[model samples]
Target: MRQMPPENPFDDDKLKEECGVFGVVGVADAANFIALGLHALQHRGQEAGGIVTYDPEAGFNSARRFGYVRDNFTSQKVMETLPGEVGIGHVRYSTAGSKGATAIRDVQPFFGEFSMGGAAIAHNGNITNAEALKRELIDRGSIFQSSSDSECIIHLMARSLQRNIPERMKDALRRVEGAFSVVAMTRTKLIGVRDPRGVRPLVLGKVGEKGYALSSETCALDIIGAEFVREIEPGEMVVISNGVVESFHPFERTASRFCIFEHVYFSRPDSILGGRSVYETRRQIGVELAREAPVDADLVCPVPDSGTPAAIGFSHESGIPYGMGIIRNQYMGRTFIEPSEQIRNMGVRLKLNVNRALIRGKRIILVDDSVVRGTTSQKIKDMLLDAGAAEVHFRIASPPTMWPCFYGVDTPDRDKLLAANMTVDEMCAHLDVDSLQFITLDGLYRAAGVPEGRDANAPKYCDACFSGEYPVVPSDMIAKGFEMKTAAE
Candidate 1:
């Protein structure tokens, strides 16, 4: 029997991207390419991985595992099982699914055999209205095999009267609400779709003369030697068959409200978005943060790994020396064992250790991408103080995350977020820091290449966590007495 990995007691106070999806058509050993792409996207999700392939002889084949892509999809013995020239894959960190005995069943590349032909789908992002849809479908006699929000699409497609898989998929999407970027495969075609708001990302790429690929980020394409063609636009769907590609727009047009956090945290530094380098954008964010909130400190330090690039920019802009005061353990997977009371009190020593020699008797400015729950920040502060640092100040790269995200990111509810209920002064007190400041919302817009600033009437991106302005209405939450906060509020 498969069991879930132990939860880490030393979890960081950061939001997590839910999943990554990839697909390829007209390629030999398509599952191999899908594996490579999923490996590149491993940073997005690491709990579980799956691949589904279609062949004329075998019809459809699927393999799902409860671990990293590199561990599960690398072996020649495993790759040989999925023989096809068309396939789709997914890497998941569960946002919606039962976390019990049936959890592995929820790992996706969900399949459905319609009257026309069978289609397999791998999806990123959450479906807010899934519970309502699931009840309605069950009332109509649809038996769900897994307890996952994504399975609603398969059942919805099974009930569609549309002529083809793409049309059925369109019909299904029209009924669902919230963010989605999907990669799917029918017996004859590979399909990709992004939601109307473009809340999650999907990119198109070309491989040699006869192959095409769809991936959550350009980094996946880079790993497989594929050339990025373009990002799949909001509300756009592409179908690839027999080396030919066709595009369709099924949903009504809306201004693309891409997730701003993609720039602040989610995406890989090597990937490009909207033609801007992600690393450069992050560096600019740090530059903006330094300009907006400078501190009198002897050294600037980063939380390590994710915080490195921004810290470099802060050091450059603030004219402060940058040093590695905190060193992270390289082998620490996000997974952590359940801690006893004594271990829980021990805090960050498991994943990070302070370089006491560099930290002693120095005032330090710490740069991190964002703060979510405040636990990690508090622990880091205590660690720094224990290391004999004279003072510790925090400069965040983004504005206070005052609202919960209902899109692809796995954010805590509003009540759990420290910024949602506290002022900067209150947060500083809570963390027991000398000072705390976040980058202004306008400064973030400037760093994101919109120098004119966020227009109150027509905002360019989804800053829901910062601005409480969600592009897509969260229907399920509304039904549960959750009120949507408009930009004016």
Candidate 2:
């Protein structure tokens, strides 16, 4: 069902950053490699970024700052200040900590100091049982600092047995649920792990003698000139030391149901998830959408960057001419701050301006990957109509989002989702569009290269945001640990 989006209403339907992490070891420039990898995976987050490097002589050196990777991290002094042969980095979008309310503590590469030496860790997902675990730890007298779920893992590691690093990590990992693709750097080793269901993407790569780089997307490897190895198998722990990589499966294996949203929205188009090029797959989503909903559109105009490839495919299959309608003013959008309702609205307007000449008096089919808040979609569609579009037909490449994410996405409460309360016809009328359609779940599965029952384990996807089958249930779905603590303080 589709409900019309309000011009300024809240929506939890938008795709969100799942978080990005990367680590490298035994290289002369591990710090640089990590920074580059983080840049490639920048789409994963923009709220905060950091890198933690390990050196025998100086111990661990960490540099992090809140904001976009280019804006805060890798600044001239930051890059000069960071150095080591082994390190880990993260690009984060805070779901809890209030805007500009976070300190260095909130940023990741949360370091753990214990009897077995220390380790610097970077995480790429949310913890489902965070509140319960934090409460339990608080009862045991664990001092909480930041409201980040990633910090929970650090405290868990600090309390684990001191025998071996891998054993300690595994001990803590087995207790956490939801989605996670973690990378950690001990004084001597780099380690990576994925949840049993593989709800998030993590890949292992080799770059010369340094040999290993672990990242949320394979495109990070391309940024650093590393050769792509296979994915870090779900439910497995990978330890890379002395230019050698080994795997250990301590947790029971589960079905390989990778998060389908990665292909539809989260990942970099150039990146490869589950061994498929994200750019190519998104285009296929468009081709499939065209076959499913053959609309009478004079021209196809993509929503911009992420929507472009699929728009091309829709144009390819539907015989409609593909034209660039929205040109993102990246320079402006990147710097625009959204601390209030008015600013967020003004920011969106300034971010993209419709081409009156192309859209005016034309039957336009606007192809977008997904409609999260529908705020942006409604505004954009209206912008086209204001530019004199004869008629606007909306084509979404994915199913409507009905559930909030427990993994990592900062989905608003369920009630805030546009798809939650409205049907497609209702939504079309609400948005005042000429017509609307969404790709079927079956079509979404096919776009991922999962052909029917052929692969056996094929088509298993996390459509929690669409079907509401949450992979893991967080104890308190509404707990704003990050903000709740602030008010208490």
Candidate 3:
């Protein structure tokens, strides 16, 4: 489980959604299995969740529940409530949602009337060109109920060709900029698409006979007893129908630079990624961290669940004992839900407590994936110091998150990032640590390499969040965001 931020001041080290999408076809109870897959993928998004299932006898049935999957869509009774053999699921993080119209309308599985009947689509990535596309659609008299970028694709599909939904989706997809791993349902076809850069995860799986599952991670496949197959390629679309699956990458293929963050902090340990095990990848990062920056510390401690892999690797490499310094109380549902001001403070305190027996009088090297705002790390350092650690040295397995991620990650605005504004020395001083080391960008790429920088002909990454080099620029670059009130908005 990941630690959340406080109500005000954005004081918590919250990592946003990396976007999770799932699809299933051909299983006996595929609709229910899709729900199970969604439960496994709930970690990807906590804001809005939904499932669109189809029934051969009746029709497409959808059950949408907002909030955590456990609280919103738990119970076999609920699973049985949905009907269908083929289905698609989405857990989302909102970007443009507003109180009046955007939030409600944007809850996905956007359905539209089209030439080839109708289709329901759910998406997990942001489109840099959404504003432009929305403007174009509105100008052409297309009405929109949702403000989500996901809905843009639905409208585009609606205004597209009659031959096939998949082809129409591919045609529309070719025009959109940024990351997307889309799953759509139609009367006769189920479609899946991944953007050219492969910034998000979308993998293929099979349950038994005539059944397949597509998801952002393998954990869902495990839940539904679906065997892991392969990843949907960058610039590719796959369609399922009549016990057959076909793929088309009409757009030119590009290099795959699977988002490095997936292995660093987003994905579950049990999931396999990009030819390597997630746990293995995180552990290897620790091994590399030790080789690059090693220290003679008494104990190697992980931040919590996210840092466990690197801690083990650090311990193995340093020949130092590994100990669970911070014990995370998995039972804490939401840190923000702590009732009162005092309880909120206590809730943060109660979430994790330093293991006194292991840290007392020991020089500790604290290993974590990355630090967003320095507040949480500083507090943890103070906590460890209070627990009697002789000294604290912080080691980050992934490169410092120097930039915000706009594609799907819930990164704060530029000024909020610690690494972007402060020097390494300044950051260490701010966190009040004896020393600190971050994995280099080159090292990150070397560990989880991406395609060569934008070749003139190939599709590229929207590193705007990382490098401030967004693929598509806003028409109103000077305008305020959704958070701004009427005057600014």
Q: Pull out the clashing pairs in model 2.
A: 1-422, 1-423, 2-422, 2-423, 2-424, 13-372, 14-372
Best by lDDT: 1
Cα misplacement distance, residue 246 of candidate 3 (Å): 0.6
Between 2 and 3, whose TM-score is larger? Answer: 2
Q: Rank the candidates by TM-score, best first.
A: 1, 2, 3
lDDT tens string, model 3, 141-161?
A: 988886566778877777776
lDDT of 1 by residue, 409-428 (tens): 77777788899899999999
| TM, every model | 0.96, 0.92, 0.90
lDDT (tens digit, per residue) of candidate 2 on 357-376:
88889999999988765777
Deviating ranges (above 4 Å) for candidate 3: 1-11, 99-102, 335-338, 449-489
Question: Where does the lowest 10-residue lDDT sum fall in candidate 3?
Answer: 1-10
Computed on alpha carbons, the lDDT of every model, listed in order, comes to: 0.89, 0.80, 0.74
- What TM-score does candidate 1 get on C-alpha atoms? 0.96
Q: Local error of candidate 2 at 7, Å?
A: 18
